[model samples]
Structures are given as C-alpha cells and as structure tokens.
Target: MIPGGKSFCTRHYKKVTHCLFDLDGTLLDSEVMYHTMIGQICEKYGKSYSKDNAVQIFGMTDREVSEEVCARTRLPLSVDEFERQLLDLARNKLPIAPEKPGADRLLTHLFDYKVPMALATNSTEQSVRLVSIARPKLFGMFNHMWTAASRTRTSTSWRRVASRTNPSPHNASCSKTPRWACRLQSRLACRSLRDFKPELFGLPPFNEAPPSTTVPIHHS
Candidate 1:
C-alpha cells in the first residue's frame, strides 16, 4: 500500500460515490512498455528516441504520437503505417505490465463499497485490452469503460463518453445523469497519470470538504 493510502481513502470516502479512472499510467504500469517499444522502433530506423521525446508524447493519442515521432525523426513510414506498427508492438509488450502502486487497493475498496466507477482513457480499445489482459477481474469492475477508438477519434467525443458515464456535478451544462454525487472532490494529477487535470473537463475542484461528506475520486 502507498503511504497515506488508508487515511486518504477514509478522509474522502464519504464525499466520493463515483470514480473515474484513466487506464494507462493511472491503473496499469504500461507507459514504460510503450516507451521501450517506441524506442526500439525508432532505433530500427536509425533514429534516436530519447526520454525527452517520450515525455513530450506521454499523453498523446496513438496517431498524435506517431505523427510526432515521424515529424521528429523523419521516419520513412506514413502516420497510418506508423500507428499500425506501433500498436502491433504494444500488443506484444503491454500484457506483461503490472498495475501501478496502490491501484489495486483503491479499486478494490471502491468495488467492495459498490461505488459507481468508470474508465475514461485516451487509449484505443485494442491497446486497452493489451494492457488489461493480465487483470481481467480488475478491469471488469468498472461500471463503464470508454476508449478513443469507440467512435470518432476526437477529444470532444471522448469527453462526451466520459461525461455520460461519470457526469460531473460541477458541470451544470452537462445533460447526462450521474449515479451519485458526493462532496469530497479528490483528483490524482501527477506524472504517472500523465499530469491529466479533470477540472479542465468541468469536473469538481479538489477542495477541503467538511466531515459530513466526501467527494468523488477522479484519476488520470
């Protein structure tokens, strides 16, 4: 368990009735696999793939990452070809990846409590399956799951699916109904999760709430 995991859960339990999780770095420890695979691909073409380059493409979609790599390294493949080859390599590497520290503990706690939870990831469904193959039970616990490959590959479409699954009470403009609302708004915005900020999507702000209620947990 991570330090302060118990206290963090206890403190926010009451305020959180629903949770939204990002898949790649937040739940599964698959970023390293991706970096390695991409590095190998670049090396095959006599191109350099550095940590600095990986950092820049960390949160990008497969197409975006492919385009960036081609732009930076001048790889001989087109964007579509690069994306296909990258995903093929990822399919072979991601299954061996593990979950992040404290991910299982937090997910189990929420599942046992029957908290409504959903996965909101920028990964394609195929890529998600590759990373999740080792933990079917854990992935199955989500009430809903949304991936970028489901419909049009647009950020707005991705947000629409996520918002539908875990409607943010903070967004009065959102039309979808949420399962429950809580007072404690906890967010995990860090390097491991690609420094994603839920507030940009109109999710609740992380503020100190009174003891009477806790808020939803949103991880990305």
Candidate 2:
C-alpha cells in the first residue's frame, strides 16, 4: 500500500508479476517460540533475554540469533551449544506454531490466481520444513522456497527466484515484516498482510474489503 497511489509504483517499480515472502513473522507466528527458547537458554546461564533481544534477532538466521543471544546476554554456552538447544526447542515448538491471521487468506488468493510466489527467508531449510509441516497445503503453494543456509548469494537468490517465477527483480515484490530485512532494490515492508496491496504489484487483489492503509516501500 502507498499513499501516493499509482504514481509511486509507476515511477519506480515495474509491474510485479511474482511475489517473494519472508517466513517467520510474515507467514508463521513463530517469533514467540523463538523468544521463549532464547529466554530459557539465557535463564539457564543465570542471564536474561527480553523482548528487546527478540527484536534484535528479528530477521536473523539461526546461527546469527545464537551468536547475538550469546554475545548480548553473555551466556556461558558457545554459539554451537546455544544453537543446538535452540534447534531442539524449535523442533518441538515450531511445528505447532500458528499462522498469522491473514496468512492463509492472502496466500490462497495468490495461489488461486496462479501468481508466481516464492518463499525467500534467512531461516534454515530444516527450520522452514518443521514450521511448514503442519500446513503443507498452504506452504506448498510457493513456486520456490529458499533458505539462507543453502550458501547461495542473497541477491542472487532473489534474482534466481525472480527469473524462475517472474523474470526480473523489477517485476517482483518482496514482503518482509522486519525493517532491517527490506534492503533489496524492490522491497515492500508491511506490519500485516491486510496492509499489503496486491494490485499495486499487478497481482490480483483480495476479494474482500480493500486495505485500510498504505505501507512503506523501500527501494535502492
């Protein structure tokens, strides 16, 4: 969504033919699980992990989160040890994590319209699989799913997905919840799915009421 209307998209972005999405917080409500797990690990080491720590790791990968948590909290465990505990908790918690309110509605609308969509997340493939296992039908709609652990270049990852799904970065739209993650040339950051305007990206709009407000666009 944009306050300036078509002028914004017209002046900058090409008509987006494909959608790229972030997994955590955007689609899955797994942040709580992460917070809980990190808190537990910190407490075990006589330290504390707070909501501030959660915000700091908003778009971080598993290893990155582990590193940050360990460094920030001064936890006694090594990064690898912290990660092993985190992964263990995630394996148990993430599968049962709920989807955000509008996740199904928005994803299904795009899928039914045959719009190319991909999941581009900094999470690991193992993490994504565990989280999506409960809702295979929903997550399966993505034309492609990428994880940072794959060792691919980040920009190249987006471009490859774009070529396979839409053709170019200019013709793609990215949806991310974390502000720091919206560093791409064509990125859209929204607080919720209800604020995402598909028509602005040349995709089919929702059948229900229109978005209530506009969202910020970050392009380089």
Candidate 3:
C-alpha cells in the first residue's frame, strides 16, 4: 500500500532515491542565534529587528538582507564586512546552539539506510567550514554541499533546485512552522513538499508533477 507522498508530485515522492537538505535550520538548532544576530545587526543600524523580521528572512541569504539594510537604513559598513561580523558571531555562538532534537536521529537513520545526501545552504564557504567543525558528526554523511558562493543562491535558484531534482525529496530549512521565507517562495511548505506539487501551493512549475506512489515509513 502506497501512502501518498508529502509532496504534490507523486513522481518526486515515490521515486525519491535521495534527499537534499538545507543546512542551517534544517539539521541544526541555530534559529534562535540567527534571530538574535539579525536583531543585533538591525539594532546597530537603528532599524527594528524582531523575531518576526528573522522569520521574514528565513530562507534568504544574509547578503540579500544586508543589501536591503543598506538600501533602507543606509548602514555605513560594507555588506562583506557586515557578513564577516555575523559569521564571527555565529562561530562564537555555535557551541551553545544545539542541533535540532529529532534531526540528529533522522540523519542517523537515513545514513544507516545508505541514503545518498546533499546539503545546500545559502551560507558561505567559511560558514560551512565553521559548521562542519561545530557539528562534525552531523555533517559527516553529506557527500556534497552547496554554499552561497555557488551561482545558484538567488531566490530563483531556490525554485530551480526543487524543480531540477526529481526522485529526491527537497527538504528546506526547518524552522518551527516550515513556511516559505520571503526569499524562498520557491519551494512549497513542509507539508506540501512532503507529497503535493509545490506549484499548486503558489510555487508552481513542479505543480501537477507526476505523483509518487511510495510512502516512506518514518519511525522515531
């Protein structure tokens, strides 16, 4: 009996032979730190940065937000310098931000299944290095990683990744609600992405894609 896939596309869900995960919030517990840093940055610029603001930029790259800050608040520092500071802050804080509770277990089980995995993040190469060091056990399974330096970090890139990878489950950054961040209107919501076509959820293109017949049995 094939339980319906979480994504709208049956082809994607049923045929999913691999998994591609977004790094930061998906496997790690850095959402609070991310929210804090965004607050700190916005505060330095005399702008309002709140949890809501952090939520707003959930799936976006820091560079995009920095540009917005420069345009809106006219922040004095260069975006690169600003991003460096943010990364520095994150490095110092990584020890305290734990991995998400169930994520480690999920990753471990997936590894045991010999599931091929890829990690795609909007973070920089340095950030990736820092995270790998900060969470070695968690990152060891990833055979591939894509960072912000890639040509495909834009908002459009987000959509493209989802559309390009058939027979693979697209796991976005895992905040509490799993809603699309302003930058990531590309992928569908977590529930929709589980089996429904993202295009039907206002993220078309993958809309009405072939249906997947296999339902993965997940256990804690």
Candidate 4:
C-alpha cells in the first residue's frame, strides 16, 4: 500500500533469484544482546528506553539504530557517542558467539537449491570480522556479506534478486492489477520468491498459517 495513494504499480518485482539475509535478528538471536546494551547505555545517559519503541528498529543498521535512539529517547548525545556506547556494549556483552537455530541447516538447504544468498549486516568492518570469527565456516555459507555503511561495498558484494515480479494474489480480482509485487526495502531482508507469504504482507502476522505442502527430509 502506497501509504494513502490508490495508484497501483505499473510493474512488480516478484520472483527473486537472489535473497538478502539480515544476520542479527532474522538469522541470529542478537536482539537480547542489543537491547541489554541499549538499556545500559540509556541508564548512563539518564534516558528512559522503551521496549515498544525499541522493537521498531529490529532490522535497522547501526547508524539507523543510533538515529532511532536519538529520535526515540531524545538522548543528549552526538551520534558518534551513541555509536561508541553501542560498540562498547557489544564488546562487553558478546565475548563469544553462537548461531541461531536452523541457521546452518537453512543455509545448506538453500545452497542445495542453487539459490544465491548474501548477508547484509549493520556491523562495521571490525565488528563484522568479529562476528565472522564466531562462525568462520560462514565463508562457505553465503555468496557475500555486505556492511550497510558502504553503498559501493554492499551494492557490489550482495546478490540482488533478479526476478521483477514477486506476485501473490489474495483478494484482488484476477482481472484487476495488484497494488504491489513486494514490500522489500532498505535494511529489510526477505526469503526467496518461492517462499514468499501472501497473507502476511499487509496485515498482522497470523498465529499460524494454514498447513501447506510439507516435504520430508532426512538429516544425514
């Protein structure tokens, strides 16, 4: 939905040959670490941190998170200070690292399907290298990993979804055109076109989706 505009898309980006994956939340359970750090930083600044407002920034990059901290908490600090605090917290909190459940399994499965994948993370070069140290095998897991700060780096490194029509029709008449093909955006990562969800696009997340085709797998 175009905010308020009824104007529909003349075209759509539907089928995705390549997929971008966010490392922190979408793949790794790093929110607990982030929030704990944020809360500590806010205490030092005498600012109240709201979890609800914090949840608004799950998929954001580090710079985006700093901006949100300023905007949401009205903290009296330059973005640089915020960044320092965040990094300090990262250093203190995450001495060792672990991958989210099913992460490697999913990577192997997607790789087996011959689908290209990239890791788009907000972490800087140093932090990115650190996170990588947590999983050196990650080099074989993804085609690339791009830090969000550098446009040139991310643009060239990460795989871009090639297909232009990731369409899913729900209530819209087959005769009528769709409002959009997909809602992919900056700092947001998505699965491939074949795994796209139609109903969860606009509305609240369903408690559970109706059971669809389930393929049995043998974990050797």
RMSD of candidate 4 to the truth, in angstroms, is 11.0
Candidate 1 lands at a TM-score of 0.67
Q: Model 3: what TM-score?
A: 0.62
Query: What lDDT tens digits, residue by residue, belong to model 3 across residues 71-159?
Result: 55566788887777777787887656777656665556556656556677887777678878867888887756778887566333443
lDDT winner between candidates 1 and 3: 1
Candidate 4 wrong stretches, greater than 4 Å: 1-18, 94-97, 112-114, 152-220
Residue 130 of model 4, lDDT score: 67
Name the TM-score of candidate 4.
0.57
User: Candidate 1's C-alpha lDDT?
Assistant: 0.65
Q: lDDT tens digits, residues 4-121, model 4?
A: 1122231232332344566665566677788878888888889988879687876566777888888889898988899888987787555465566656655565566554566766
**lDDT (tens digit, per residue) of candidate 2 on 124-147:** 888988877878899889878889
lDDT of 4 at 35: 81
Best by lDDT: 2
lDDT, candidate 1, 1-220, per-residue tens? 0011122223332244356677777798788888888888889889999888998887677878999998988998898988888988987778878888767766776677665577877788888777666678888888677787665543344345545553332343222222133123223234443243223332333333657656788999
State in Å the error of residue 73, model 1. Answer: 0.6
The 0-to-1 C-alpha lDDT of every candidate, in the order given, reads: 0.65, 0.74, 0.59, 0.57
Give the clashing residue pairs of candidate 4, or none. 13-164, 13-166, 14-164, 14-165, 14-166, 15-165, 15-166
Q: State the number of backbone clashes in model 4.
A: 7
lDDT of 3 at 24: 69
How large is the C-alpha RMSD of every model relative to the true structure? 12.1, 10.4, 11.3, 11.0
Query: Each candidate's TM vs. the true structure?
Result: 0.67, 0.75, 0.62, 0.57
Any idea what lDDT model 2 has?
0.74
